[model samples]
Target: MSGCYIHIPFCAQKCSYCDFHFSTNHSYQNEMVEALCTELKIRSESWKDEEFQTIYFGGGTPSVLTSGQLQKLIGQVKSGYRVSNQVEITLECNPDDCSTENLTTWKKLGVNRLSIGIQSFNDEQLKWMNRSHSAADGLNAVRNAKQTGFDELSLDLMYGLPNMTAEEWKSQLLQVIALNPEHISAYCLTVEQRTALSKWVKEGKLTVSSNEQQSEQFELLVSTLKEAGYEQYEISNFARNEHYSKHNTAYWQGVKYLGIGPSAHGYNGKERYWNQANNKAYMTALKQGNLPETIEILSSFDRFNETLMIGLRTKWGVSKLQLFEDISPDKEWFKIVKDYEDQQLLIETPESIVLTEAGRLLADGIAAELFIIN
Candidate 1:
């Protein structure tokens, strides 16, 4: 089944660590909405008639949109695409943007899933992160969503802060467990270039977490969540039973999807395309009847490398035998896999090469080590 992702490039305010395409200017709200709808129409006509199983609204903050604006966008999607009756419609929201009224309206507009960005329950952490919501706002938002009958709730949390203690991390996890969300996406705070967080670190205004601290927090997360009966479906995601995010899992499995809006990426079985990240440029090009995107045709090696990278991040490991089936297995790939296996970092079954729990802690490094150099 195909999936669709729509990026809403507006936020209440820019987060310190966020590098996503977004503006805090409210003046462009109406124009942005119009451009998004136009993009949907433009992309939909070119798309083959595939029934969509998932429709995800992600962004700088999708919750910034009003209920009326949301209804209009969903209506456009319904008119343009063949969405299945069982579509998993998700809306990414921030606590400050959610209220009882808005939650009811969101539910009415076919939003079956709510992904709330509740990074931390601690007010200090929230302030440090420059989030648009308070700790109380976050707690209220979850209750409002549940009251509105959204059982498919996923909360985003972050660990590995510069001054956070292990006790604080454990406390946050316990609090989340108390809320009883269906899924939890816990991420380590990474300082990307050009973000405020990086600048603060450089200027000595803020301290970044050391590798050891990050590793410790990750271990705490896995052990704590597992004890609470959550499965580590992905390296960074935990879910209860069959409630894993179908939309995200489809992407990890290399399924075809259409992405609309500025700074969005789409992948078919063969090629990948990314829309222009600049909102003004995207709207201007689309208004001039252009798609405003760049495409890359994947080679055999490229596809193989991608499959290897994505497969390792997932619980469903990649088959070593299947690697040779897709491309000529070279000594370089074999050496990397064998090195990891010998270290007990990877468990090599006859059919699959799976990451051990320790290996998952260093997944990016392991995946990078296996990249097919051109």
Candidate 2:
């Protein structure tokens, strides 16, 4: 099924580890909102006949917007697109921004899921990450959201931080389990270039955890979450009672979706497009009745590589028959697959091929090894 994503590119402050396209200067909020609606209207024609099964409000921080602004944007989408009655609408919120009143208002506005950014349960870690909220704020936010009847709650957790011990990581996971969220997205902290974290590491002011430590933490995460009755649906995502993130699931499944707002990316079956990351440029282009996006036509090889790359990381692995037919017709590819299976890195059933737990640790490398180079 198809989905829609709206990127809200406004944050009160930048985090040390964040490299997403967002601005601290929110002076252009009203202009950005209007521009977003205008862009939505212009792009709605393409997906007019298709019904959207999910809508996601991801961002710099979607919680920064007021209820009125949220209502206006949601209304614009509703009027323009054929959204399903049972559509799963999710909003990414920060701990400090969540309140009982706000949660209730969001529920009233048709937001069924809340993905809270509670990166850590330790105040010290929060400060190190430059998060706006404290540990207490995070706990309170989850309590408030739960009290407001949000059964579909997701929490973001980070591990592999510098100087973070295994005990600390376990404590964080235990605290999250105690909160009883429907979904948990645990990510290993990577130092991307141009981020403050990268700068600090470069200056020897901060030391990232060793790869061995990171791998150990990842194993702990999987084992602990599995014991807590959460299914590891994806490499980084754990869900209870099959309450996976539909929007993200659709994305990994290669479903076509429309991405609205600055710096958003959209994918149809054959082509992909990304909006300009600059806020001023995005607004200016929309105001001038032009769509500010760059489009790329995907070759068959591109699609095949993407399918293999994404599919191997999920619980539902790539279909063996389909992969053999669509991606590689040569016996050499089959030989490579057989070798991985022999090494116990890949599990091959009659229908599909999936990575074993050991293989998942080297998933990217394996996917690259299996890539068809011309």
Candidate 3:
């Protein structure tokens, strides 16, 4: 259950809301591709015995890369690592890049899944978000992918925007449902520091939605998607017929994986590693035969806290037996769990601790509250 994640840090246009590491400058695109392959080979020794079940092309925008570049990268993966016969290859595409030609080429190259970033289908909202594509582009992208024989389609939808109404949020979900994608990842928009959205917040140019509104929208998302026959597998992910993102699911379950490219993070069972976020620095390091990465050794407390934090965010929940594998739960930890259980915020079954819908709204906070200090 190992996965490979390749980060392509090139974006044609930087969205105002984005704070992720990416550059609008693509002058070194060719060099970056070569550097990525070089890095892949450099790190391949760690997982030589294991086969990668999934390979994800995530980004700034993977769709910005050409067909030749994609083939080169995928080709590199096939040759460098032990791959599975039915490897799930996913590419995160922007709507404008999901043309018929692009989709067809991707299909031929064994790219089975398309995770299109259709943040919102409203033209006004798209402009507000400074997205590259129009609402029409998004609709056609899904149609194009389906026509090209791609069945495993996952669409990204953003909710919790500034001053959003329940009805408006409902409309967005309905639009996504009409597209009939195999998976839907709906996220709440947060104003991150240094982002334009954050600037707007500081200057009072935009007002964020109320907590009550956000809660209503989330509840609405759960109900509407459930009615549409999509299972809310994770807090933000809905899937039809269990078309889970193999790479991300493996991550939640604490499976080891390699993260290739600048700003990408990787994990074995015990340690975590992250590459340099700067593109030039990363390329320079690889060119000089040096790895531009930092490594962290996880303490027992770190492991226990992570297990509970990530495990509680999904429908599968945290296994009760595995909770104490790293360290003993302190008195306050037991008290917190008991309180949440009594409030019906979470369930304490014989085998697992699963969050109820109400509890999931406060999941991260609850997980932190229950963390044990070493």
Candidate 4:
């Protein structure tokens, strides 16, 4: 099913490692909300007939918005789109943003799931990440979300930090497990270029974790979560009782979704669309009743590579029949697949191809090797 994503480009404070589009300034929030609704309306003209089962509020910090701002945005979606009765609406929030009052308001606003950006429960790491919340705030957010009737909870964590230890990672995972969230997403910390993280690394002030350490932590994460009854449904996500993130799952499976607000992206089966990364430019164009976006048409070559890139990172894997239908694999490509299967890194079925546990650690490298370079 199709989905709609709203990017809130406002954050209280910038995380040290974040490279996503956002502004710390709140002077234009009202204007931003209006612009977002406008874009939603403009894009809905062609997609209004499609039934949407997921609506995700992602961003700089969706929790930064007030009840009125949120009401306006969700109201716009309800007015313009064909949302299904079983639609799952998720809001990305920071721990400090959660309160009984705020949680109640969010629930009334049609937000059924809360993807809280806990990041870590360690106070020092929280400060290091420039996170606005304390460890206590993270704990309170989860307790508060459950108390407010948000059963579909997803908490985010970061592992493989610079100088992180195996014991430390295990402690963090246990903290999350104790919280008993319906879904948990753990990400390996990467120093993306142009962020404070990269600057520190370049100056030799910080040492990023070695690939070997990260792999060890990843394996630990998989086994620990599995013992706790959570399924590693996707590479970075774990869910209990099959409660996967509908929007993300659909996105990975190549479902079409309309993205609202600056720096958001939209994709259909054949093409990809991304909005202006500049907030002012995005809002200005929307005010002028235009879409500030670039669209790329996908070729068979492009589609085939993309299928393997994303499809191999999941539990369901990619359909072998569908992959061949997209483009014929060359002799070399087949041999690479054979080598991986022989090593038990890949499992090739007549119908599909999936990564084994050992294969997941090398997921990116393997997928890259299988990529049809232009």
Please list all clashing residue pairs in model 2, or write none if there are none.
none
lDDT of candidate 3 over 240-355, digit per residue (tens): 99999888888877788999999999988789999999999999999999889999999988988888999999999988777777687768777888999999999988898999
Q: For model 2, how big is the CA root-mean-square deviation?
A: 1.1
**What would the C-alpha RMSD of candidate 1 be, to one decimal place?**
1.6
Against the correct fold, how does model 2 do in TM-score?
A: 0.98
What number of backbone clashes does candidate 2 have, counting pairs of residues 3 or more apart or in separate chains?
A: 0
Query: The CA-based lDDT of model 4 is what?
Result: 0.92
Per-residue error for 260 in candidate 2, Å, reads: 0.7
Candidate 2 residues 1-374, lDDT tens each?
69999999999899999999999998989889999999999999888878899999999999999899999999999999999999999999999999888999999999999999999999988897899999999999999998999999999999999999899999999999999999999999999999999999999999999999999999999999999999998899999999999999988878899999999999988899999999999999999999999999987788878888988888887776645555554888878889999999999898988999888888899999888865
lDDT of each: 0.89, 0.92, 0.91, 0.92
In candidate 4 the C-alpha lDDT for residue 71 amounts to 98
Q: Model 1, stretches more than 4 Å misplaced?
A: 319-325
CA RMSD of all predictions: 1.6, 1.1, 1.1, 1.1
Candidate 2: Cα lDDT at 5: 96
Off by over 4 Å in 4: none
Residue runs of model 2 more than 4 Å from their true location after superposition: 321-326
Supply candidate 4's per-residue lDDT for 146: 97
Give model 1's TM-score versus the native structure: 0.96
